[model samples]
Target: MKAAVVQEDKTVKVAEKAVPKLQPNEILLKTVSVGLNPTDWKHVKNFSRPGDIVGCDFVGKVVEIGSEVPVGEIKEGEVRWGFTRGGVDGERGGFAEYVAVDWDLSSVVPSNVTPQEASSIPIPFLTSVQALYIHLGVPEPPEKVSGEPWILIWSGFTAVGRYAIQLAKLSGFKVATTASEKNWAKLKEYGADVVFDYKDPDVVKKLKEATGDKIEYGFDCISEKGSVQLSQQAFRPEGGRLILLLPTPSESELPRPDVKTSTTLAYMMLGTPIQWGKITLPAQPEDRACFVRWTKITTELFAKGAIKPLDVHVVGDLDKIQEALDMLQSGKHSTKLVLNVS
Candidate 1:
């Protein structure tokens, strides 16, 4: 197999490596499409363990299944989309020609979606699912739970933000979100109650005014310094919930007690719980159940179009992995980037 490995020089190089064997609960996916995220490079520069395989979001055909995998849940040659953890990605990653997938993290791609489209779902969709369902207590999809408890999603056009907006809407929560004016119309079409320009000089003030402090929950997909502060403002001063996809303040910058905040690690989709700066936390039985339920629910939601696949900036070959990574880091693409591995 050939995978993109992160070298000590911080360069990504495609190198040949042995194929990985599956554990009793894993499956082998021969990569058909790979989604490149900004994290692909961020993980390389920051969280990297040298020589680590460097990507995670993928869609492929199942070539092998573990003994413990439930019969009929998935089959050889069936197409599936999934994501895996970083840092030690050699045995399992979308950047390679093949990856060992935890069966729980893999889901069948609906017939209506192409492999390239499915490849763009796992990281963003699971990140949104975990943030909304697992942490913030948002109602599950298919049950329309609407009312005064509105939600705020920062960076509405981001891959995760895009899914977060749709999922929140599907769950029946009214939403207020921020993005560029160019994206405002589509965000609204995707179900946001209101869209404000994130670059506005009064962006936070605008969000505060638009939602009337009634924004009781928020998912800060951006989590850059300003993003946290703004997301904090959107939630009611009286109290609310917030989920971040990036590193938050050093306990010192924590928010008001009335307002609860937590960060999500999407790799948890594989049934493991991970804490930043520290690795190797054991999977919690309850969390494993949470992730499994998330997979099943979202699989249905996606197939029915309750959750739409993201628009993608498609890169046509694995040979251009570095080119795709550079494009992601350039921050110009408003869509997810998928590498056609075949």
Candidate 2:
């Protein structure tokens, strides 16, 4: 298989590598599409090393399942979408033509969604799902808005932020969001009742004006610039909950407030308690169960078209992986970038 290896910082090379085999609880998948994320290049450049093949979000057909796998419920030929941990096992990752998927992290891709679309969902959707529905006690996806809470997603144009908006809408939140100017209208279509431009000098004022100063729930999709700071302001004293997709501050970075804050390592959160327990710090059963229920809910929303995948910037071929990465880093791509691996 021809895979892109990060030979060093800002350097990548297409090289042939042996295909990976599945472990007892894993599934072997022939990659059809790979979603490029901000982290892919960040890790590659930061490490300045050759080892990590860091692409995560993926969608493909399961070619083989382990003997211990109970895939009969999912079926062998089903299309699926999911996140993979960085550096799966000992090898690099989904940048290649194949990946050994841990069964627990995988989910069936709706037949109606293309591989490119499916690939875009796993990481971003799971990020929003884990953060809002599980961690913050937001309602489950694909459910009617029966008593749903209000949520303010701080970056509605981001892939994760886009998913957060759609999920909140589908699960029954009166959603509000902040985005770049051009995306404000699109965010409205995605179900944000109010959309504010983060670039506006009065962005925080606009948010407060829209919510009437009773801010309670927030999802901070951008870690830097004005987004994080404004989010802190929007959070209500003790009722506030903020979930960050980026690295959250230690006690030092946290504001002295009664608000609750959490960060998610989304792929790892899909595990069963046993799987999580193996890592030494397991998810509480309650947390694990909420994730499971939300997973099913999000999957159903995708299947029913209640929550749509973000419009993707489809980079034409695997050979253009570098260009795609460059585009993402340059902040030129407005939507998720999907590599046509097939």
Q: Report every candidate's CA lDDT.
A: 0.81, 0.73
Best by lDDT: 1
lDDT of 2 at 179: 79
lDDT of 1 at 59: 85
lDDT of 1 at 81: 83
Q: What is the lDDT of residue 60 in candidate 2?
A: 74
Top candidate on TM-score is: 1
lDDT of 2: 0.73
Candidate 2 lDDT, tens digit per residue, 145-246? 465556889888888888888778766778878877788788888888998888888877887778776567889988776466678776555457777776
TM-score of each: 0.93, 0.88
Off by over 4 Å in 2: 87-90, 141-148, 237-239, 250-256, 270-295
